[model samples]
Target: MDSPSLDPAWTQRQRPPRLERRLGFADYPQVQNFLERLERLCERRQRYPDLGFGRTYVNLTIYPDQDATNVGDAEEDFARDIDGLLN
Candidate 1:
C-alpha cells in the first residue's frame, strides 16, 4: 500500500544542530578523572556523551537523549564534578 503523505517540511532533514555548552576546569587531575569516568560509562550507556577538549576547557554534547530544555539533568548525572568545574 502507498504510504500517507507527510507535510513537506517534515520530509526535510533537520540541520545538524549546533547545541553545546562550555565548561572549564583548572584542576587537571580532577577533570581528567571525571572525563575518564564518563568515557567508561558511555561505553556501557547509549546516551553517547561527547567531550570536545580544549587547552584548558571542554565542551559537552549529548545526542539522541536530550535537548536544550533538559540538558542539565544529563550534566548533573554524568558530570558530578560539574560543581567543581563551575567554581
Candidate 2:
C-alpha cells in the first residue's frame, strides 16, 4: 500500500479541503431551518467528535452572511443563532 506522504498530492504543506456553503440568513426561521438541516446531515453521516470514552460531540460555527456595512448586529445575531431560535 502507498503511504500518504508517498502520494503525488502529498507535500510539506498540503492544503486541506474547505467545505463551504453560501447559506442565506435573512430571518430567524430561515436560520433555524438551516441549523436543523445541518444537524440532520451530521447525524446521518455520523460526523460526531470522539472524546476517547464513547462520548460524541457536535461542534458548530455560525457566521453572518452580510457585508461590511451590516456586519456588527447581523454577525452578532448569527453567532447567537438568530437570537436563540436555532437552539
Candidate 3:
C-alpha cells in the first residue's frame, strides 16, 4: 500500500512512507495505541520508536515494561516526549 504525501496528524512531520504496509493500511492508530501502552510503563525519556511508515503491526504484551531508560525515574516524562512526537 501507498501512504499519503501529506503528514499524518498523529506523528510530527513524517516523510512520505517508504515502508510497505503489512495490513494493506497505514495502521497508524494501531501502532500509536501500542506506543501509548508502552509509554505507561517506562522511565522519563525521549522516545523515538519508528515502527516505520505503517510497515509493521504492533504485537503488544499483556505486561508492564520499561524498555527505555534514558530519562528520570518516571514514565510520564517519556510519555510526554513520545506524545510530542505523536502529535
Candidate 4:
C-alpha cells in the first residue's frame, strides 16, 4: 500500500513501516498531563501507539494496523490527532 501523508512533526519509516514523533515538556507534571490526554485519545479512538517517556519527553511510535506493509489512512489520522494534543 502507499503511505499516507503525515504531519511534518512525525517521521515516516520504511522496513517495519511506522510513524514516530518526540514531544517535549518542561516538567514531569506536564508529561503526566500529556500522557493522560493521550490515554483519553486512545480510548476514544480505539487506537494506541507505542509510548516511551521520561521526566520531560515522550517518544511515540505508530505502526500500521494488523499485517499491513505500509502506513495508511488510519495511522495518518491517528498521528494527526496525537499532534492535536499538543495544541
Candidate 5:
C-alpha cells in the first residue's frame, strides 16, 4: 500500500511503516480523560494504535491495517481523528 498524506503531528516511520505521535497533557486527570476518549474513538473506528503513556503524556503508534508495509487512507484518517480528539 502507498503511504497517504498524514496530519503534521504524526511522523511516518519506515521498516514496518507506521505513524507515531506524542501528545502531552496538563496532568494525570487530563491524560486519563484523553485515554478514555481514545478508547471510545478506537471502538467507533475499529482501529487501535499502540500506546505508551506516563502521568502527562501519551505516545501512540499507528500501523497500517491490512497492508503491513505502508500506511493507507484508513490509518491516515484515524490519525487525523485522533488529532481532532485533542482539540
Candidate 6:
C-alpha cells in the first residue's frame, strides 16, 4: 500500500465522493417529515444506545462529557445503515 502524504489537516475534512448542485424542498410536508425523522433519531439515540456493536464511541468536541456517547455512536451507525439501504 502507498503511504499517505504528510498533511496537518487530513482528518478534519469531509470530502464528498463528488459534488453536485440541486434544489432543496422547502415545502411543508417535506419540512415536517424531516423534523419528524430528526426527532425519531434523537429519541432512539436517547432511549437505546446499544443497538449497534457492543462497543460505542463519542467525539469529545461537540457534546458535554457524559455517559451517552455509546448511544450517539449507535445512532450514527444506524443512520449509516439506513443510507446504505437507500443506496
Model 5 accuracy (lDDT, Cα): 0.89
Error in Å for residue 6 of model 5:
3.3
lDDT values for all models: 0.49, 0.34, 0.36, 0.92, 0.89, 0.32
- How does model 2 score by TM-score? 0.33
TM-score of each: 0.46, 0.33, 0.24, 0.90, 0.89, 0.31
Q: Count the backbone clashes (under 3 Å) in each candidate.
A: 0, 0, 1, 0, 0, 0
lDDT of 3 by residue, 1-87 (tens): 642233222222223312111222256776766556556533333333334334345421111134532322232333344334444
Q: Candidate 2 residues 40-83, lDDT tens each?
A: 65475444211111122223332323233322343333333322
Candidate 4 lDDT by residue in tens digits, 1-73: 7655576889999988999999999999999999999999999999899999999999999999878989988
Arranged by lDDT with the best first, the candidates are 4, 5, 1, 3, 2, 6
Model 1: how far residue 77 lies from native, Å: 8.1
- Write one digit per residue (lDDT tens) for candidate 6, span 1-87: 643332221122123111111213346565455444544765755632222111221111123125543323433344443233222
Measured by TM-score, the strongest candidate is 4
**Model 6, C-alpha of 47: deviation from truth (Å):** 9.3
TM-score, cand. 3: 0.24
Residue pairs with colliding backbones in model 6 are: none
Query: Candidate 6 at 66: error in angstroms?
Result: 7.6
In model 1, state the lDDT of residue 17: 35
Q: Ranking under TM-score, best-scoring first?
A: 4, 5, 1, 2, 6, 3
Q: Which candidate gets the maximum lDDT versus the true structure?
A: 4
Q: Which portions of model 4 miss their true places by more than 4 Å?
A: 1-5
